[model samples]
Target: MARSTLLEVMGRHVQANHDTALQCWDGQNKEYIPVSYSLLSQRAFYFGERLVNTTKADQIQGQVIMIACHSPYATLVAFYGAISVGAIPMIFPMPLSLGSHEALTERIKHWGFAFGTPAMLVLEEGLNEKFHSEIPQDIEVIRLSDDPAASTETRSKSANDHQPKSDDIAFFQTTSSSTGDHKAVSISHSNIISNITGIRLAVDMADDERMASWLPLFHDMGLVGAVLFSFCNNYSLFITTPTQFVKRPSLWLKTMHEQQCTIATAPNFGFDYCSRLISEKDRDAMDLSHVKHLFIGAEPIRVSTIQSFLNKFSSCGIDAQVIRPAYGLAESTIITSISSHKKPSDFICVEADSIAIGESIRIVDTLAFSDADLSRYDPSKSVAVCTAGKAIDDMRIDIVDEDGNKIDAPGITGEIAIQGGSVAMGYVWGGEQLVEEFPDQYVRTGDIGVIHNDELYILERIKNIVIRNGENYLVSALEEQLAELLGISHEHIAVFESDIHDPSSDIVVLVERHAPIDEDQINQLLVAMPKEAFPINQILLSRAREIPRTTSGKKRHFYCRKLYQSGDMKFQQAIEVSPQRIMQAQALVNES
Candidate 1:
């Protein structure tokens, strides 16, 4: 088998599609900047060669290079440039808001140790100083805008450069740790290509398809799936910053419409964000029916989100089926399973224990569930519905018991284990690849799930489950429920087990409210929740601007738990609260 290099695979396609090989949203111009394939590769080679020589006067092969850029263009240029020099580049997303320079420095310091001072950090403008003196002086810091490669000066290719192989590590993907740490998993070139191939096979990626995404370059879905996949497959990719999308979601719709984008992707919260925040007036002039593969992943799929987005955008000519529900992990390059062929998503509504049908959470109830009758399982209960679709190609998945034994039957809950070419090279630890033998084995996904007739359904991360009355419920599910009840978006609500052992109530639900805490709303929640769902001990009202989120935008509940315990969260509890938690909640509110 011939070795497949990143440049080798993408360079071939871009040779002809030079005109619109890459299209990035030019916010200043209120338009997109289309860079030709020839220009893109030209910059990659010129700067790549320069990077190889400037960083070190030796073989660049296998050297871990880091690229931190705010500009999507800068990140792309530096990434391919580093890769072109045969040095694996790990891309990190510039933090959205750093509040202070000290916070930024701390973040960089963490990353420096995470990868053990990569040979060089191709940092963005104004960010070079954050890493200065904090890390070893030997680790060179190259400002992206400074033109480390000096684009104008043609640099000669060195023999040490361009030695990429199939099995070589391509880049590192960041995975969030529970302890507020960030871990980067090594992804190989083969893993990326194989995963993209699986995406192509699973979704029937058409040659005529054009891609659009606002997901940050740091995440795999944005980097590999949208950005690099389109490049390698010879299609135009439309890129924008996540901040721009949040500020004006209408731009995303407009960009998609203008480019006639056939494929697009976002996390569940993103769709929910646009669905709620994007007013009907904002979408009056848009058309979205052209989209074929509107992928939703990077977070647990919510039935309400899919329905709400589809419902809200249906007026704009979007087919409800175009909104897909998909599942994946950073361990596997990007997407492993995505619904395709205009199929309506499959939603399984699991009966919520001690929940009655008349309850509030029952609004999401769908009839397709097998446990429809009260006899099969208690039907008089508020149920949580999750969209679980079929698996993609080139991937093998299994539901395993606690002991690592595979579950023989479908619908049995167990840990989700995945075996595929998409599986990353291994976890990077102490400047070395920890599991070199990882390729031959299944990456134990720490996610609890059930596979029914080959369809994968994620329940929750093993750590995020809250058990009450001997019945388990996911914190995400509670978040989803509280979002509906509170008339707020899902991402703003966080649920976690503050005290796991308490018999009466241990779970704490935190709501991100911009204004002062509403005592009436808090009282309403105390009255409505204890009967419909799990009993929440206390509701902590917080003003945390950036909900601690993973690169892919999944909420970090464990971190939030710590913030609550340490009293660091800008939380103002309602003056009046639950009887069991009134003393504590009121006391915290009194301090404010």
Candidate 2:
């Protein structure tokens, strides 16, 4: 096998399809915006040349630079340009509110000072007029345009700079984590290329495939998987913001149906939301026959949720075989395991008790699942409706037990450890020290899983397990029971530990319910919930429409927990009126 650079691989596709439409989007004016492969390549080449000439990126091969832009075209160009010059691109998140703007700017200034250089800051064209004064004048800002011939006469300084080796760092992706958690995952060009190849093989994607996505570019799946993979593979892409999809889930299907998109991907919540929104009348009018791989990922896969969606949309041309469950993280570039097409299987459920307490997985007959002791035997299958698939071509995955020993059995559940060409070289900060954190060369994905009959099944996040009294409570287990009992939307339910005065531990459920519930309804819910499964001390209900979520609809649990702890969420309290009030008023009038 030839080991080619990312640019080398992508250039081949660009050369083959120079005039083909590669990326298309709707602009602010609702007009279709199109960019071709020839244009995209030229933009990347010139921008990279300009950076090498002015920024001396060859000398600072391991340094970090931030790119800030709203336009999809500019972001893509700047991303490829930074990688082309052997500098790591750090994508700064857009400030959510005006209040956060100054603090985020201060953070950027501190980071720039620490890096000891005015990092290259790319801005959207119109943003110059809006916040140009706020940006430091010392930092270089470049504007990427749709024209392939764009250039500045004063740009030539040192095109003679030496090129970088394949081992140099390419980018640092920032993920949401605790301060103690190392959130940034460093990736090299080789790692990214391997990931692209791995994903291409895992999904069995074709050259003519098209992918529609609404995930934010800063996120791993959107940046590496959706955009870069699409560009590298000569696939057409239709992308928009998460807010746009949330406002109208129908639009995702409508756009896909119109474009005949074959490879569509999203987190588990996205599918749940789409299933809820697509009205029977509207679904009847739409066409979804072209969708081949509707991927559910970025979170644990729930069997019931997927089955409900298939049952709801089976009449609307949605082939149940298209549902694919995958597992991956930023540390592994993007995709580690994806569902396969040839064998094809539906979502499977399993016992949650065995997962958390028994430390094993036993595939009980799916038919006998409902009648089994609901506490000991999971009503749903332990395995999800999908499989995480075999490791990609050059990658390797191992299920290991404690004491760092690899497990050989198919039913034993353990930590999922991955290694191979696509596994990131190491993280950005702490260098060798961070490399030491991982075992040998494998990145221990903080996820639990099992290998069954050569396929992998993910259980739950290792960090999310709650230690209550002497027993351990897996949050996902509690969440699953709550979803089935309360009829709460699976996408909106999150269970976390709360600090209450009770000696017995407390678990809080932040549910996204549309209608306000009275105390009686809540009490009934508590009564119906399995007592041994999840002992609820307090339950909080909030509407999903008002809840803050990522562009992918994953809940911001950290922030929501903070708000709840501070007594910020509003809950309705019923007040009683008595007839004795009228007698008291009459007595007071007589005395007057």
Candidate 3:
């Protein structure tokens, strides 16, 4: 807290641990490379000086700078370089799926539209043409060399010569499109520090703890939580690329085991992927006993995924309780609530229809509630909901109904709204805050959840629900039930509501299974589904692995619905062989 800003925090860590090192994967040599704090400082200094000179020539200070780099080292150097010289840095996603030149150009142009021309852009080669064509600012795109500071490069000036205040904007993190499309959340030096400090305390971090992370640096989890936090706390960090994890997730665990990492994290789907993808042979050889807290959050925490992963790896010394479920969003700087102690995650199962984000706080000041009141809020009686741990220090939660009325009773579904120090400055559009009708500080998370036993049980985002006949159904729960009934993995199914407000709007469920469903099974499932979950007016089947999802593995219900409404989507009917219903089904399937 004594440090004025992240610049000071980084400086202190470098000064104190000059010899301490970070271990990163070297893809070419298939070995981990050690990069010391002193070396990082020198590289940062070199990049910082380059930025300082550019901004000085442009006669602008505090110019927003964008950095899009694939290599973690290059990104760290570019980011620190920008901020060390008083320029704000924004780390952008380097889409690995950019397979074609047109795709790359469109992606860069899309980014340019969201971020009004930054004074300087630090990107890897071959991405500047599209950037320049779309942006109108007097922009200078700095190409990051493979090893910019590897040679005998001396800084012409001190790295932290330009000091920024605590209130200075540190960076802008893009919010995930759970509620909607992504938006930039301006995070301040103080905001980042507050979140890190709170998380450090919540998890009771120790000096000797080792951290390993593969999250993209563009996201707040990797930016503020993993990279910055590791440096600030002086913990030895083992970093890897997200692509590496996707290609062979076993590497994440293998590296963690080899380095004896104590702290690690992933979203729900990450765990599911690793559990399913990592072969039994690979799983048997790995050891995860060193991991103390595998914090799980970023999206809805799936109880089934956690349980299956634990069962699959427990023989390899991976403790079941180490799988901690957490809850937070970009608006709150990544982690607002996380499991802080050594306890098994409390899980509950409830009727999908009965579950609602109850009234922990429908209104902020109008209710008197305490942790002791959690005795009355028993999740086991209703549902595990999420039991997403408690709020971090100085943070408060409110669950309100659709009418804006407070819901104080447990198990009552409502939208989640929060107020805390970790909250971002505000939503930014075109480099300006949208304050027309939004709150000055507190963020309405748009996630629906209920508070029980002093923990958050997230149901789903308010926008993710399917409402028909005045009944709201959680699509995730329906998908889980349908997958079990189909004897297929949950990834094979996607359920959503189309034409949302129309009285005759269809409730469509899509499944991508290897085998087709017969007419009898289809009729039986449709009949039972309405009673167990909700009515599915239409069922569209696609080839396996064809469902679209966000980068974080969240099912893109809205996107899939859009694709289905347009015959342009690639998929065939599952019940196309049924002579009696093929015409009706095809008409509904191709209705869009």
Candidate 4:
């Protein structure tokens, strides 16, 4: 029989056994604590019983139950508990830093009213206290305790009396808010199962495959790709928090080594951070030869970053072929396309000027091109794009022009559109289902990309394009060029148009500075920019971590631009080219 809903999958795993389902890292003890499938099921049922006894059945039957727990175990229990009761569960990250207390309270209140959220589950005492004191009485606040004894006494009718159908909503995922405000994407149980099935087949998942992840539970890649996928497939997983990984990158590797995990996933930044921060001593103590797949996605995949990571970790038994650059969005239930494990990621060099909408890209094939060849390409004239691989099973990808007509020619840049079983039903906001974003079962991804050799290649978000003087430039490409010229990580740089509507508006460049760079260096950087294609207009330098970023470490270019325009971003130094200099550059372009 085919499994339709998440509850069905959970039911299969509920049989009492000593087999480990999850190995949660204890950061304080520096060891992994195992959680069995039967124990997890029991705790989830107990939590569901408590929820059913306290809240009205009508309130939870199909409404949203918000979860903001820090622990992965607690969060999963809360998540499954909500599902057991037929309520939609939404996981959100708890506030990591001590910011404004009132602001946090207001934000919680806003979500409560907006989603008509009946209850909130939290584990942290400080968060529990804040909610009780400030949150409205209408919104019930439930504090989950980690103590085992607290849940042992519970035995009541399980909330499984009403079962959900395959098309029923499984959960809600929020956009990263990189381009705009956060919106909730409603994914169905069938959507999840279909995506999981596709990913399993695409990666050739095995019965003995063990997984490890440090990504937060709130993110789609962590929730769907790591947690739910493993749970549904009965794969053993090792889990930890993002904070732990950031504090000690070695923990992730050590856990992987000890557990002999075969699969792991992270954004491109994770590999870069590990390569840069992990000590040589720690690297020598670990072996990654057993790691079969390292799925990289959720942000732009930099070839340079991947090569650097491979070179740094090759001594630790890491293979260059394990790096899999993927492309996905929240609307697709986590994965759309992933590079195949059969070969290393493919790359191509293209003339930058030929990347305009509805135009065929001119491939620079005169040289034997590879990811390492990025340094050879002229930053302003060419770009090296990596393949995100073919669409997964039953998923169809098409590159469409502005008119929504499909672009038939390969290598022509257009908006990427998807049609697949995993496509989300629609978006929700303030407890109301918004109008359908996808019509005719096709989703316009709002991402710009191309098709080359029958494989998908991501370029940039439609919103990330900067138009000046009737020419368009990819902001990410420009940022990479600037980073290379300045000898810094591209992750620390942001480039966008100051006034998107004004063709002659200044091109704003924001750099997050880690070390001091003198004025002369900055001036040289400005002068070194390609005079014809790029005119150095304004540069702003802020302290490290000042630039706005999503939780997944992607630069929020639109948000940063708004901050710059409003004079809210705190910058240590600001440099602007005079109008005469700008005119001179423009004249130079005219002469060319």
Best by lDDT: 4
**By summed lDDT, which 10 consecutive residues of candidate 4 come out lowest?**
174-183
TM-score of each candidate structure, all chains considered together: 0.74, 0.70, 0.72, 0.77
Q: lDDT for each of the candidates?
A: 0.66, 0.62, 0.66, 0.72
| Per-residue lDDT of candidate 2, residues 304-328 (tens digit) | 5566677677776776568777778
Candidate 3, residues 8-33, lDDT tens digits: the string is 87667666765555777877777777
Q: Which segments of model 1 are wrong by more than 4 Å?
A: 1-3, 56-58, 97-104, 113-118, 126-136, 146-151, 154-159, 177-179, 354-380, 432-439, 463-592
Number of clashing residue pairs in every model? 3, 9, 12, 0
Candidate 2, superposed: residue stretches over 4 Å from native: 49-60, 97-110, 114-118, 127-164, 177-182, 366-386, 430-440, 464-592
Residue-by-residue lDDT tens digits, candidate 4, 140-228: 67777643334565433256565888988888786541211235788889889988898888978788888999888878988998998
Per-candidate RMSD, Å: 10.8, 12.1, 11.6, 11.5
Per-residue lDDT of candidate 1, residues 301-338 (tens digit): 65556667767888888865676677787788877676
> Between the candidate structures 1 and 4, which one is better when assessed by TM-score?
4
Best by TM-score: 4
